[model samples]
Target: MQAPINIALVGNPNSGKSSLFNALTGLNQKVSNFPGVTVDKKTGTAQIVPGLTANIIDLPGTYSLYPKSADEYVTYDVLINPDNADIPDLIIIVADASNLKRNLLFCSQIIDLKIPVIIGLTMMDIARKKGVEIDLDGLERELGVPVVSINPRKSKGVAELKKIIDLAARGNYSAAPRDFINNGALAKPVTDEIKKAVPGKSDYAALHIAVNADELHFLNIPQKAAIKQTLQTHQFNKTKVQAEEIMQRYNRIKHIMKSTVVETDPLQKQLRSEKIDDLLLHRFWGYVILLVVMFLLFQSIFWLASYPMDWIEGGFGQLSGWLTSVLPDNKITDVFVNGILAGISGFAVFIPQIMILFGLITILEDTGYMARISFLTDRLMRQVGLNGKSVMPLISGVACAVPAIMATRTIENKKERLITILVTPLMSCSARLPIYTMMIALVIPDRRIFGILGLQGLIMMGLYLLGFFMAIFIAAIMKLFVKIREKSYFIMELPVYRAPRWKNVGTTMVEKAKIFVTDAGKVIVVISVILWFLASYGPSSRMQPLHDKYEKMIAAVPADSPAADSLDKAFRSEKLSHSYAGILGHAIEPAIRPLGFDWKIGIALITSFAAREVFVGTMATLYSVGENPDDNNATLREKMAAAKWPDGRPVYTLAAGLSLMIFYSFAMQCMSTLAIVKRETKSWKMPLIQLVYMTALAYICSLIIFNIFK
Candidate 1:
């Protein structure tokens, strides 16, 4: 049996590492957590040769091996700890060819581990376009490794890269080490100490790590006594001494590049991207442009999704009506149509909005605008006791709070990250859209505010803004209580802008949609079925007698009586629904009575916890029960408008609708979100806290709204 070779893919952020991993492994990848940690671990297998399989692990992106955050720690630990279960037999250091200087910092560290390393130079097309020419043979000689230029997006050079991996695994390729130590006599003692500490480790890499101890914690030394003694004898601080050695290595790299690399145009460095970035990164217009971009993003969510949402709603309504006509009037039919089918369709109705939101985000990220957003938002974030990196999680909260919370792992400071996670759920997610749309349509007038902002649109925007501002406010308050001493910095690479990759955007949309439908869909289907059964059968013995009595009264009424037809329909529908099950619904009706909700609305709320959008479908299903075949006003909106309370008051008064919207906006109603939070946080405490806080807030807020309106 052939032994499977372990290969680790490492790179800086946005170096096309993920794209390369996807191309190499395809669907053979599995994402899990590192042992005892919530950090993501993505591993896959690629056939490196005719019979040998290579297990490829995509390590988290980091600038250096010295980790400050939980996610970064995983990468640092995996690389240095040989006792790790997935220790790589070979290391592939992926570098962005466009930014060689910064990329090389990581490569230099990896090389010091004395492992066989190959360089996968990504984005060579970008480098070529900028009039940069790399001497591959010279680079290989200087780095003591084979360098392969790959455009993973285009599937270029991947096969050759794989072949190189196979050869490296078989110990078939070796390059002579470049001379990095020019002052070997002066640094001999320190280098010897490092070699003794880590047996067989590269002297050059150890020297670099020892010098830059403050910047990146490469060495696991508990005390600096030995290094101090060496440094004192040499009259240098160990940190500065290590930095000087790294500079020596870089000087040699620069010398080699001067000989082998060429620039066709001297002014090619001042490119169009640089010119555009000057404006986009400017202090004033940069912020204005960011605001405008965000405004447009939110506007697109409502305006663009409106037509598709209507289509989904209409299509589902028609389907439900058709099912009612086709299926026999039996318990099973009722469960299938009213419970399972209706529930699934209800959740499916929100796919267009979710897809559009995800697609836009993916596009922004691909074009490097997300990093810009992080940079722009950093100052404001720092004011609220969060590092600039916190912006990533906050923005992610707009799509789903669970991943947003998980993304907080990138924030190095523990207190700041915890506070960010605690408040992220306040951001208006796509899940809240159905509730917002339904309630706004029902309550807020369709007119403009001051002849400028649409009233409904303004309210919607206010809700999102409220959530955002509240998150910051809460974080600020939490900052005063939590004690933290770690220093935070915002040193992020701003990649050159590029056109969005449609393939990546499309794949993201499909994947998110699949997760939503499958995970949330199951819970919704079960709930809807239970609700259908509850609403369908009653104490039929008592119900039948009461219904018969009403029927006879209608029969005994004078044929010419003006109220005969209307009275008979009302009496029959009521008696049929008012059986034992109906009595139970009525019993709970009074509990929700304070919020201007009837038992039916209570049922909708209960079922909608599976997903907020299911509220519309639940209402549609409930109101359609026992209706005649020719009933007009087929839309939920139309039916809701015509619905009346027992006292002849409107069931959907402006007060009730506003209260409902408030309730949905604040409720922790998504089971999938809860599950994801549990998975990401690695405990149920945080999610349980979220559930309690959100539910209480929703109830209190809705209660206040209903009472004030009443």
Candidate 2:
């Protein structure tokens, strides 16, 4: 029997670490939060060979062992702390072969930690494309550790890497034969004292403990105090010591590279990607290109997805009709057909748009244009008291606020990160896309703009841009009030532009659509069923009188006559108006009447508090419940268009539809988002304040819009 060993995949950000993890582990992976932090920890089981299995943990990337952001420190602790549950039994350092010198700095630091190490080199192809060549054997001999050049994307060198890992595990689990730098001599007294505090580790590990003791979670109060006392006693200077160590490591690496690598000539000329960036990164044209790209994106959502959306709507309508006719006429049948089927159709019809949105976003990320977007927006982000790093989260917020807020872990500045979180939900997430789409269809005419652009899509783009600008505007206001001061810099490396990874894009599309179905579907179904019950039945005192009146009216006419059908219709509508759900909606009607919302709209507004997407299902179930049995084939849009108030005005007029869209845009209606905000900020106070301010803002905006349009 062999014990399973923990193997950590570590590297700088975008250094092919995650790609390698996926290559080895395949589908045997799950993500969970790291201990005491919101950062995701991806772990999987890898069958290294027939009989050998390893636990692979993909740690957050860092440029060095030093701690900076919350997520970066998670990597630091797992590697440096001896008692960490996730401390790797063996570390596979994934380094980019193209950027060997810069990559080696972190690699050498890890080598000196004396953990059993293997250098899994990546990006050899990229290096060769730049006219750089490497002698693998010479580099292996120089570093005194095995160096395996791997192309994780192609699954190249993985078998050999696994054999080496297995051999290393079976053998001594040895560290590098020689120290990359003489850590003991860097600061003899401080290193020796730290050795006592965290005993039996190498000098490099001891030095790290001395520098990072305060940030290390594994250290107790006494251990920290002792380390601090020792540093004070020895007059230790972290900056000087670290600076000297880095210089020494790089100096040694320079000698190693001279013999083992042939570098590209500096005057050889710019790479293809650099040439392409000339236009993509241009100040004037770049902005124009970005706008054109966005306009096309929104247009595609309508143009390409319209056919599939229509098919889904038609399929669901037919399915509902068949079930209604085949099932026995009873309360249970009505609930299933109207409550469950209607709710499912409401969101299911929007799956194509959701998929298109996420798929396009994934393409932007895959093609490397996403990073340039941050670069382009950096100057503007600075104007709002944020750095370019905040731009990623804001852009990601278009998919969902939970992940977008989580993405703030990458923003190092506390004030900027907090402001980013507070304003991110203002960006219209895909959940709101459903609302926007429905409203656009309901109110906006389906005509072309500038003879080509679809009016529906153009309006949709305005909503997204409106949300983005509003986020920026709110962030600027929060900047003045937050009052946290910290220095931060945004240094981004633009990856060479590559063709979109179509496979990754497809996976993301399926995954995102699945999430919409499973997560949003559950909420929509539950709300729909509950609304059906409330709308279907009323109190006995209110219902009995109506039933008696309708029964006599029905007796006055033939059962199959058109007059009899009309009386049944009047009975159902009157019955719904007096139902419990109707009573509740009327109760809140006065408060929302200024926004052109009636009791039915009020019911939707209340039920959809669980989620913004639930509004669609709420309307579906509400409209489906009281309709004539024979007219069940009418689509929701058609039904809503024909809906009228007691005074004979349309319920979803241009004024009302616009007002609803405005409310959903600014309202903090998603409980899941608020929960994540609370988790990220670790305070109910911030999310609570956010909820109050956003809801108030939504109400005011909707009020003003309704008044103007009415």
**How many residue pairs clash per model?**
2, 0
Top model number, lDDT: 2
- Structure candidate 1, residue pairs in collision: 211-242, 539-580
Error of 2 at 138 (Å): 1.9
lDDT of 2 by residue, 521-605 (tens): 9989998999899999999999999999999999999999999999998998998899999889889999999999988988988
- TM-score against native, each model: 0.81, 0.96
| Whole-model lDDT per candidate | 0.75, 0.89
lDDT of 1: 0.75
User: Which segments of candidate 1 are over 4 A away from where they belong?
Assistant: 1-6, 25-30, 43-55, 82-85, 125-132, 169-171, 174-269, 281-284, 441-460, 483-487, 537-596, 610-617, 624-633, 653-655, 671-689, 700-710
